[model samples]
Target: MKTLMLILAVIVGLALIAGGAILIAINRNGPAVLDTVDRISGGKNNTELLHKQSLGVDPRQKLLVYGERSPDEALPVFIFIHGGSWRSGNPDDYGFIARSIAPEGYIVVLGGYCLRENGRYPAMLQDTAAVTAWVHENITDFGGDPERIVLAGHSAGAYNVAQVALEQRWLEQARVPAQAIRGVVGLAGPYDFYPYDSDSTRAAFGSVGVGAESQPVNHTSSDAPPMLLVHGEQDSLVKPRNTRALAAALEDSGADVETLFLPAMTHNDPLLALANPWRRDPRIFDAVTSFLGQHTALSVPVQAETP
Candidate 1:
């Protein structure tokens, strides 16, 4: 009895420590905008061109596509969502993410999302699903494979990825198959965060805690797509345990999930690095390429016909 009691006590203590750590991380101030702006802008390549096109007339939402040239055949498409505290950010902020992965034979789509000011919860989710559906229907013109679409996001963007991937309704309403999602890459996303009494968080996230109906972990099952969860060990924003907990739930459901935690990097660093490849953690590129390679139908690059 004494031994068992001691073990139980240890377990409870560890849980409390972990919970405290996550709150601290969520409260972290992240980095200054100037720092990220300088890091992202300094590494531009004049040789590579990024094409900007409007997907629709939302005024707030525009599609920024990146690649060497228009794709001729069905190629893997990565729809990247930018992270802002669900308040501020634009498609331009994440154009670098699309560029970094385009060379690997994937079309990168960067677009804006509705903010808390515009709406919240299902509204943002609906906008994300709308973009996914639009890409699936029209990306063929640009040589993107609708069947191999993948969702990649960071921070709040990460959280949105989890929401759509786990919950079937958003994608279903858009008429996009849930099975069509090949993979998901969530960077420092809050998978399950619900503080019922905290009005600030509740206003944005309501009573749905991490494992609640709205949380991604709640929807993990064998049929869902594979997920890659990455985090920073020293990150004081979004917390590593969020990813850890989501990974555990995914594993329990027999889902193929992987995690990579960077040593010294922080929250915004990963987002900035996704654009300026040289400044990013190599593991970020490696994991993303590996995921895309797994789902692509063509083992080798499709060759264009000779003139």
Candidate 2:
């Protein structure tokens, strides 16, 4: 009887040890990270102005505002969120991406949020939703229309944006309707955080398990806003399958979803091309612009300069 009791004690001890290790991994931050990706990203520009605005207090989030201010022009707004695997990315890293979208007559806001190391799942999502609420309430002062807001982000940012759009609880707390969101775009984001396998992922995310309900795929419904999903065909970091799964889910629910799979690009290349406008591909811009135009009645009017 004593031998059996000793064996049970050992099993209990191992379970406790494994549980503690998982918690530690999930709560740890990756590294300090930091971007304005508004048009005129990597190149010199004498025209566009960059400004910083504080979005909140008590773990304050700062937003980078890039665009031309006008007295009579009420422009569309693109609110950008950056991805760092939930632990390491900074907002300024996506400035080039912001710049490419800004020239299309939108006020681009490249913004930051508290990460998992600082907080956790709902905390990061709350920070994003709060900043977005501030934009809806105050962006017109910067020459943007509150009614024409578009949320765009890469990787984890994409997931956050998708959650806010589908879940609605976050936006509702801020008095912003989910339908007020004109569009949402995710670039190679892990929308489904609850993983079935990959103990590392499970360890990193903790008890918030993955399921269809946890993924953005599970939230698709007829009333949801239109979506644009951009994924690199060769992106192994997040897997192109992630976007494919989401696209299928959205289509199954009758939501307007579009997927653009880029060739010869990886996770970082598409974002880099935003600042190095010379590297920008016409097809990418076309796909995004087409979706935005269809939903928002806005046009880019691009005319090739070359003879």
Candidate 3:
């Protein structure tokens, strides 16, 4: 019995040490580690094309602009929002997305927003709206056509993009016309989730009196911009039902909506596929570029090259 107890205590001590090390690594060198991994895996490129610019008074409210080296030509613009479960996420992590898509003759902007811990519900929505308005007003100087703007997001970011597109009030408050958004792309987004079963959802939306008000599915309208909803078949995190239900709602409202379900992909696979040039599944990239082509008038075909 003493021998067994000693062995168990040793295992527990090792586990505790490992856990502490991981926490310290995450708190201190997480971003650098991610950057290093992205570089080694060929997931990072076109960084020279990225230009950092401030959007508001808060330094955290800045964005990275990709493409538009030539000021003479106006290009379609795509604004992307990264997802981190409404708790943590940074625009820097998604730089590969802009690098992958910008060469396709579109100016891409990756923006950051307030997390649920910082503020709830409308906080993220408001930040995205402000960035969108800023793009509409100033993107012209950066060679982007303000009239041809597409919104794209992954996971929680997808939820924010869809919410702002559907609710209209959020953009209206920012003085941006709802109709200005030409298209939307959502990957593994939670659109119909309700009842606030999880702590993240509860913290982000439980305070709202009407649960339906928090759902993008409840805000569908015929005038909504064309939307492309992509989900992983094996995504247990957000569930395929979210995409199906939102597509149904958009269809019922006479809105243009397209749905694609990738076989054997997890919650993060779809977004990662955007960064990975050698991804086996071509559906995600094909669907996104195709959808943008059909909706937004691209000056040139997407020539996104693998690094």
Candidate 4:
């Protein structure tokens, strides 16, 4: 009887240890962990880390360039915007994405923009447009093909990128041609949430008034670039309906659009997967790379220098 009790106690202890480790892995800041590891490793060995550069005057406006710099030959570029509910988040938080995708022969640009506290509604949109304009004029210097730039983002950043891609006003205001953007990739974005009930929503979109102009779904047009909309099936923060609604609108407008709904993913899971490639759902990377390849000249893989 005592032997039986001892065995049960051992089993319970092992279960508790496993459970605690799992919680720590999931709850920890994945990007911060990667950043710390990269720093300690003397990041010079990582091509992605070595090629990172900042653009624009504000500290918030930065870009992480990936791949070898080839001034003569312009390479396809991907500008990724980070998400923090339009309140917090920086380009540095998404270095993992650039690190993962840059080796595939594309110049990944992780861009940062103003948040709600700086300005609301069109403010963030305008910031993104400015970044696009900068990329169009100067990306060639960084081995990026200006003509084949793809805009991508997650959550609030997705909303910003979608708005900039769908509506021409912001780009026009920034003196960037509407056709400069070749494609868009959005993850768990809120495209049709209106009648704001939450403080965060009200802080960003409430003052603009609940109108069709404020929604990305209402801004879709046939002229808009091809889009890949990804959403988590279990996403409770933004809901899967946002992806469905945007897809429907884009299709209705005769625009090229694709949608992917991953099972058992939450609002943050997709980004987390990008940071930790070994985690659940490698499909996010596959779908993004495949989609970009189909639309841009990113099919060729670039050779990374051995560290």
Best by lDDT: 3
Q: Estimate each model's TM-score.
A: 0.77, 0.77, 0.82, 0.83
lDDT of 4 by residue, 1-307 (tens): 9999999999999999975775476456545555444344433423454345455566786666666655346778888888877877777766667766776777888778777767477778878887788888887777888888899999988998999999888888878776667799998999988767678789988866645688899899889999999999999889899999999999999999999898888887776666543434578888998998888864578899899
| lDDT head-to-head 2 vs 4, winner | 4
Please give the distance, in angstroms, between residue 302's alpha carbon in candidate 4 and its true position after superposition: 25
* TM-score of candidate 3 on Cα atoms, chains taken together: 0.82
Model 2 Cα shift for residue 260 (angstroms): 0.8
Q: What would the per-residue lDDT of candidate 1 be over residues 72-125, giving only the tens digit for each residue? A: 567788888777767766776554565578767888887667776453676667
**For model 2, what is the error of residue 191's alpha carbon versus the real structure, in angstroms, after optimal superposition?**
1.9
lDDT of each: 0.72, 0.71, 0.82, 0.79
Tens digit of lDDT per residue, candidate 3, span 1-307?
Answer: 9999999999999999966784466445443333333456764354345477776665557688888477567888999998877887888766667766776779999988887556477788989898899899888887899989999999999999999999989999988887679999999999998877777888888865448788999999999999999999899889999999999999999999999998888787787667543345577888899898888875477798999
Superior by lDDT: candidate 1 or candidate 3 = 3
* Model 3 pairs in collision: none
Q: When superposed on Cα atoms, how far off is each prediction in RMSD?
A: 12.3, 14.9, 8.5, 6.5
Order by TM-score, highest first? 4, 3, 1, 2
For model 2, the stretches where C-alpha displacement exceeds 4 angstroms are: 1-50, 57-60, 196-204, 207-212, 298-307
Candidate 2 has an lDDT of 0.71
